[model samples]
Target: MSAEVDRGNLRSRIGMGDVLVVMVGRVGEAALVTGECEGWNIARTVGRVSLAEAAPVNPEWLATWLNSSYARQWCLSRAKATTLQVTLNLAALRELPVPVPPLPQAREFLRLMAVMEEKAQVDADIVRTVPAVADAWFRAETAGGWLPTSRFGELVRIGGGSRMRPHPEGAQPGPAGYAGPSVPVVAPADILQSELAHLARTGTEQEAAADVPLCPPGSLLVAVREDGVRVVVNDVAVALGRGVLVLEPESEDDRYWLLHAIRCHAADLASTAQGAGGREISHRAFAAAAVPWPPVDVRARFAEVAGRLHRRARTAAEEVGTLAALREVLLDEFLAGGSRTSRGSSPAHGPSVRGEGVQESLFGMR
Candidate 1:
């Protein structure tokens, strides 16, 4: 029930605890709202789904179960694809079934999931705070001295990768016939908020060598047309796809400062983008953008601080990835009836099961 009304229209409202299933654009996507969003109109494409309650049956437990791999697979299997997008209608979604585990078992699963979620949130907080700390450090240290400004082109070499041509024989040696180690090819997706550690690539060394030009480690990679200006340090040699731009600093010591500067001014850089099909910042425009050019000593100091923050952020991201993998494994084991305890053991350290006769029902309604 919503307290607020607009022009006598009863808005489709969802509150802090509502769980919504995306029915159209991103079919089968489920999100649990942790914040309140009252009097908000939900589009027809999204369905508000809930489970019916019986004694000792927790809603949070049911919602978590619905978002697990078991439910995701069921939803994916039933979704219908059209030319534009895939969709799962309300009727079809309602028919998807979930296992009715005993109440104690469901609660135990929720407890394990809660532990993972808590750790994820802590890691996420670290990832979010590190950049802001870097930004603040830059602002504070540069406030005393009036630094001279210079065009980005004067300080760095900016270039795009050559367009790749796929070969008939997959993963063969390069044009030079050099059969070295296979290099990871980077697309826009490889550039995360603060790092570029993942890449999409052909498995064969030959395929990687043929067309992709390698950008050396420490080069700053930027995604031009994306909504958020994503920039990251390339830790390894990588070939860039079309959507990416590589910025190589004249002095390697300036790399950390340059990365932080670009991140701080990402919105401004994104605004200068221009193109027809999709907006993109050209090499020329990107190079010509003005940047604060502080003294070498000041930049070095900032770089030292920024490097520490970057390392911490990287560690947090790795921890989050590890926890997510563990959570997935736990969910798989629980759903498969292979685990009687939350920690994957028998009655030793796990929660004791009770209320075996509890009734369970999964309800899908708008």
Candidate 2:
């Protein structure tokens, strides 16, 4: 502990450069810590203590400890909260503990986590490129103008989902009954919280008739619901906060184009929209929005280019999922002191398992 922190002291206070924090309640379903300016300040708020301090240990060691599944379980059991909900209070945050390794070992630990972080970064970099590529193909090549000057409603079509009676508790577990041609009924929570944006269509005939909205295969789904200060338009597993629009392209040729535009303008939409409880955008708002559509020939050119880029993005994403699993395996091998270490092999070069089963990508809407 240092000397008394002066309330009026600017240096002692954290705002600009301190980590952009993820409170305990918001971490899992919300996002992982989003970094503050220039990206050096990403951090999480844990209950009972600053995880960086409690172990009297290397911050890297602390990072690995906090990231472990076991630690998540422990945090779940005693997550800090008030009457409204559980939250990590700063005073409580200081109480957590970590395993202190020798300084040298701690250095190694940081090195390994850094590698994992880098792989994760690489995966993200690939995903970020998808939009730019899509834009070049759809907007610039096809429409001839790839500028933000066009509003989404003018460029794409947005639609509402079906409204069912306020769903009753324990009526059933999931998509019940025959869900015909439509995809399964996915919850707002699932879409808003997921890291992946693409969702496989699934459900029974009855479910289709009852709750699930029958969004055509090519149409992107939008949530009209409100959460906190914003409305959410969700795609690619990220929620466009309230008043954010979801575009379902008018034709197959236009789908990726709309997704690209919506992604490009998400923040701007959120900022410009206004409402009391949640930011509001009416159907009129969408119908009246304008876009920079060039000529029909250009639109056709963009479609071909974007389709190729999208396919590449999809393939890269598939590989990234495999890498994420590999990273996890490496984490386990190091933590358990794997048997292969005695065979003259590095622990970092853990054996890889070929992905055999059909598995869900962790990056999308549920």
Which candidate leads the pack in TM-score?
Answer: 1
| Candidate 1: Cα lDDT at 154 | 90
What's the TM for model 1? Answer: 0.73
Which structure among the candidates has the greatest lDDT? 1
Model 1 backbone overlap count = 4
For model 2, give the 10-residue run with minimal summed lDDT.
357-366
Query: Please, what are the lDDT tens digits per residue for candidate 1 over residues 18-58?
Result: 56777775566777655656435566677764333433335
Cα deviation in Å at residue 202, candidate 2?
14
Instruction: Give me the runs in candidate 2 sitting further than 4 Å from their true place.
Output: 1-21, 28-56, 80-86, 90-97, 100-109, 136-158, 162-209, 222-247, 261-278, 292-296, 315-320, 339-366
Task: Assess the local accuracy of residue 229 in candidate 2 as a C-alpha lDDT between 0 and 100.
Answer: 16
State the lDDT of candidate 2 residue by residue for 1-366, as single tens digits.
Answer: 223323223232332212222344543221232234222222233211122222244334444655554444445455655644455444333343434445675587668767767877776776657656665544344354454455656666565443332222112233545534422444444344433345442111122344443444555554333432112222222212223344566775666555555445455434333457443555565556565555556556666777676666666667677765665565556645553333223233322222112121111111
Q: Once model 1 is optimally superposed onto the true structure by TM-score, how far is the C-alpha of residue 79 displaced, in angstroms?
A: 4.5
